[model samples]
Target chain A: MSVRDENIIEVEGLTKAFGDFKAVNEISFVVKRGEIFGFLGANGAGKTTAMKMLIGISTPTSGKAKVAGFDVFTSAEDIKKNIGYMSQKFALYDDLTVRENITFFGGIYGLKRQQIKNKSNQLIEELGLEDVKNQLVGSLPLGWKQKISFSVAMLHEPKIVFLDEPTGGVDPITRRQFWEMIYKAADEGTTIFVTTHYMDEAEYCNRVSIMVNGKIEALDTPQKLKEQFKADNMNDVFLKLARG
Target chain B: MSISVRNISKSFKKVQALDQISFEVAQGELFGLIGPDGAGKTTLFRILTTLLVADEGSASVFGFDVIDGMNDIRNSVGYMPGKFSLYQDLTVEENLTFFATIFDTTVAENYHLIEDIYVQIEPFKNRRAGALSGGMKQKLALCCALIHQPKVLFLDEPTTGVDPVSRKEFWEMLKRLQQKGITILVSTPYMDEAALCDRIALIQDGKILDINSPEEIVAKHQHVIYDVKASNPHQLISLLKAYPTAHSVYPFGEYVHYTDQSGEFKQEDLHAYLAHNGLKEIVIQPTPATIEDAFMELAN
Candidate 1:
């Protein structure tokens, strides 16, 4: 199958349990390559648990899944190398300069030195960060740092990038700009697996899955989900599901 | 005024956290400080709560100067910082008791002050606070903040990362608190929450941009926002931005919110331009402006 038509991630009956409690239970979903998929839920709604399994960090108690065409059970290392991840709390190294951080991430992703240099320059230029390329990431503004962190996550040209509540607490303009970057990445055929608290952001995704308790309660286009739930917006839809 | 701030300024070494900013919150009013991170919301709150002193300007809470009458202010105000600050190892009830003791009171003395918020977490009283869910942690923190029945409350982004359901529920609690005549000075990055405030000061980059009722702010500066959609949103955004008359274009939800530089213009001219550029199913409808739109305009 062509990259556009193939599923970058396929999961069936994904379950993760700690003792007697099922954190993520019997969840099944397919993420097509280049699609912006929003995984949303309430705060303690097992998103982190499910995400850990998908990223190859935490082992699933029972399930069959493939991430970046690699089986989660046997090829966790391969899945790690083929996917990129960034979160609001943790992204680039704070003490590292913008250029150095890019080079570091690129090297970690197995890029050659020359390739790292080229990508660093292109990335800095794309973000218009040439002036502050040598400044420590710690000194930069939150929006600038967030944008740089996101671009750095894609430094290795990973097939998919997972963002966790990436836009929380950012200014309105910066949040939209961040989404624009996500849109550009998805357009370039990198599947974007993102989670956000902003309901409007859920609307930006091709498909959104709202998790209630430990199961996927609703998954569809924002419009269809709204219609199905008889809600006016994603906020109402989320409230209706999460409150239940 | 319940809270009064004038020409307040503070800096951390080289960074000016709060510029010469000023505003006032009347008694029993739900005042919101709406802005994103590093907009000086926390700095202002800290100064008012007597945790930090401003380099310039003066602030008074409940008629007590923040610089000189800190103890008086402390006794009259309740503050909940953005971060979860309750004693994690302590049980929910124990933490509430600790805060109440520190305030020279007992939970029973001000039980009614937090009765509405406390009952929600009473079932989990014996559970360690660290094990509580995010929503429950916020509720418990709120209860602690109100344990002493302070006349003024300062909540710094209490719902920053909370989900929609919890955020809604928290706001409802704030409304209830307000009805009880407790003046609140709350800060949040979420613009939608601005409407819940009686008046909001749209702040950014260490300065207050505008302070008004959320309704008047949106109602006055709407300037005819247009909701534009096309076959390809990415291309549509770029094209609209390149249009000579485009004032601002930002993707809201499923559509791009566009405004003309001139505010009012011919709709056909733009429709013809998009259609000529191979765009299909073009939909351009006027939509009401929101706090986000007003912020973008003023911030832009």
Candidate 2:
């Protein structure tokens, strides 16, 4: 999949409101293809709301967003076909074995039987899931389940991937490994858009957009944000923007 | 040993949770068991607290074997689970009293130890624990754990879902507890938190990776670190990856943290390279490595 340098995801004055409350204000940003852009915010921040609009699952109250070269409002079905999503709550059948979960997700993505088998093998080997390949997902630890969920998200080889709090409760070591897989995918030309409460994880994005209340407070690299805010870590930078 | 494990292992259903993991936490030391979820942090904590029996191995707390001296271990240890396990229907005061009763102690006996944290939630002592805010719940949980004044404290991701400010506050509390001669073993998935501990043991996939202090880990980082920022940050990241000297370029907030293949590349060389690549408004600064950076280096 080839995408121009201009923008793979374009948002113009996007807005989403729930009754009198504006969940996402008039925010606009362009995400280039093959970049890992992070959405940063506190719990009540509008990051998730904005993502819902961009992914075509929730309709925007006004303005516009173009994802995968298709309008979010009119071409939502087409947009869904070109992107993969992994929610904070990973959608997987816990009762199924590792192999069965992979096959099921692959089929959902419309992969052929032989292609699913081939991809499953590569995934199992890359993730080192060989020992527990036949074990039920419910029996696996939280870290292993997280890795499996990520692999399943990329099974269909979509042009872009979206991850929501993909490493919330896992150990730091597993988080580091999860990011390696993310970098590998980015290297292979898959654009990654992720949201996270962990500021350090935000630092791992190609560029991050920080939300406060309902507006994009800051959009830059973790280093620049730290310097501009005169802070040592991403946590400080986030506190400066969010708390202020 | 204040805490000891020999060939300790556990599994939920068919998943091999812990594979003969054994370690010791000395008296009055701040020890960190660092790993993501399912790294057996919970399972190990349960075993040491005598809440769950390991299918294999033997663990002893304060020289009292876990299997044989379970009651003694329970009476002498403070345990705070990842999730707030206190009764939701009970008030803060009730929860504290309930836990104290289990260990044959009273809140009045250890009131001084928990006075600082308890005072913050004292007004809400009458409110049900479920109605308390996240930070408040954390404070209440901590107070209950400390009420008994156990020799060793087992905190399982105590700061997991709490706010950053509260997390910082919680660590400060732990440091204070350490000063009072309490041996603490805390687990967390946040790399930054690992630095606050005296020494950390990085665990993953049921295996121990490395054990060292935060400063030692960062000092051992063998890479020359550079932070790069530009007007068009995302575009700069894409450009940096294709640059000839680029070894690894990952986005770090508004700038990209990069390293070179030789670990000896100069800043002037980087500026020249960026200019030649049509990257403008660039800021390249050499920065000190953090524990998270060192953790990433070792993890890879």
Candidate 3:
């Protein structure tokens, strides 16, 4: 059943502060259901901070955020249950086998024994990981490990998946394959919200929000933003916006 | 040829690091080894520079075998790793001077070669390498790598983590370096960076997919390309993928780059279909293919 609610995430004047530094300042936007939203910024931009708020890990100092139809402050537990998060360096036990990692994460998400087994098998098979299912995660190649991490994040089947620089340090082919998996999930009606430093990856998002300093300077589809900025590509658009 | 490799392969604890990866660099050419992490890019670089050994194959720098003439290869090739691998504890000048001393040379010996980049970070020569900003660290690393007047340079993703502006500056520096007849073999994950190289080898999972100039790669993609945009791009991508004639549909910036299975499918069909499906503000325009388009086509 399609949720009639237009907004999966609603942020209103959200602010995140760390002592004297306001890492995020009054940022607000709505991420609709099943939309692939790209959050772009330089190294220290408030992208991470703002995402942290939406995911309910970091409390906003003021304003309001309703994610997965749960209030960020009061319904954090509900929000957590409705979301899956994958950081740049995803939390995968390197010493564990691929199957073991899948099981562990699935267990944590409160899946039953048969459900975890069935889902793990399905994920491993879909990703063509059957050959390496017994291999230690640390022993697997970077690209394979990234795919496994992403699969593990979705093991619980959350309504929204948040990936923060999931493609960093990997090669182009692996990135392409990783994006294919993301598209597959979105096709299944899972909202994908991700932050990336790569401009090309930003282009893959349905919509992108470019953050500068502590505020979002531009927000639109990659083509609109590129044309409005008079830039040939997202990289040039980002440079013109952020550097200015 | 400035650099050549013969049947070079490496393995790390049962993992095939590089499988007979062989390529050569012409003098003054900017060659790029484009791949993801662990595509054996760094491993290949280490072997070429004699920093690591290869189980099979051989490589040479300016006619000197890397294994047999390790010292000579080290003396003639400048290498910058993906990470800033310089001494983090030492000051910028100290690190440069230390590298110079190890090579039995001095910064003054090749001051002209590195003058442009070194000048930017010269004021911070006394500051610790660990304390320097990302861009400053990059410049310092470049200065140290070029201080010995090497004939060839190997940069393994030097622009990976640096900001876009800094990355642009770094590429400009490489262009200037190339102008002086230095053969550069740089590895990067960014496809856009491949355009900066005279030629590039696209690698995936220890296998070389395609090797050619960036323009040539794009030229090889024979497809009727259409860039389609609508009020709801996500919905549009799904709709496009579901279309019976859709050969491939992938997100391209704000629009979707789509190719049809049938040789001749018109944009009017797409517009009418999208409008019927409740998509609004639709615009379907033809666009020239890019390196990414070619890459995606090959991948599928």
Candidate 3: stretches off by over 4 Å: A1-35, A49-82, A110-115, A125-128, A139-141, A157-160, A169-177, A183-191, A220-224, B12-15, B91-93, B108-112, B118-128, B131-136, B230-247, B260-285
What lDDT would candidate 1 get against the real structure?
A: 0.92
Per model, kept true contacts as a fraction are 0.85, 0.33, 0.41
Q: For candidate 3, write residues B1-300 as lDDT tens digits.
A: 898988888888888888877778889999998877777888888888888989998889989998899988888989998778999999999999999998899989889999999989988889999988767988898888898899999998887766576777789999999998899999887777788889988776566778899999888889979989887656787899899999888776556788888976888998999999999999999888877777667655
Which of the two, 1 or 3, has more lDDT? 1
Prediction 3 TM-score vs. true? 0.84
Give i-RMS (Å) per prediction. Answer: 2.3, 4.3, 3.2
The number of the candidate with the highest DockQ is 1
Query: Taking the tens digit of each residue's C-alpha lDDT, what string does model 1 give over A12-91?
Result: 99999989999898999999999999999999889989998999998899989999999999999999998999998888
Question: Which portions of model 1 show Cα errors greater than 4 Å?
Answer: A1-3
lDDT of 1 by residue, B31-113 (tens): 99999998999999999999999999999999999989999999999999999988999999999999999999999999988
Between the candidate structures 1 and 3, which one is better when assessed by TM-score? 1
TM-score: which candidate is best?
1
lDDT of 3 by residue, A1-244 (tens): 2223478999888888889888898888988888888988875677878888888888899889999999999998889999999975656999999999999999899999999999988998999988989988898777788888888889888989999888877755577668878877887888999987777778778789988878888999887998899988999998898778
Cα lDDT listed for each candidate: 0.92, 0.83, 0.85
> CA lDDT of B27 in candidate 1?
98
Predicted structure 3: clash tally: 2
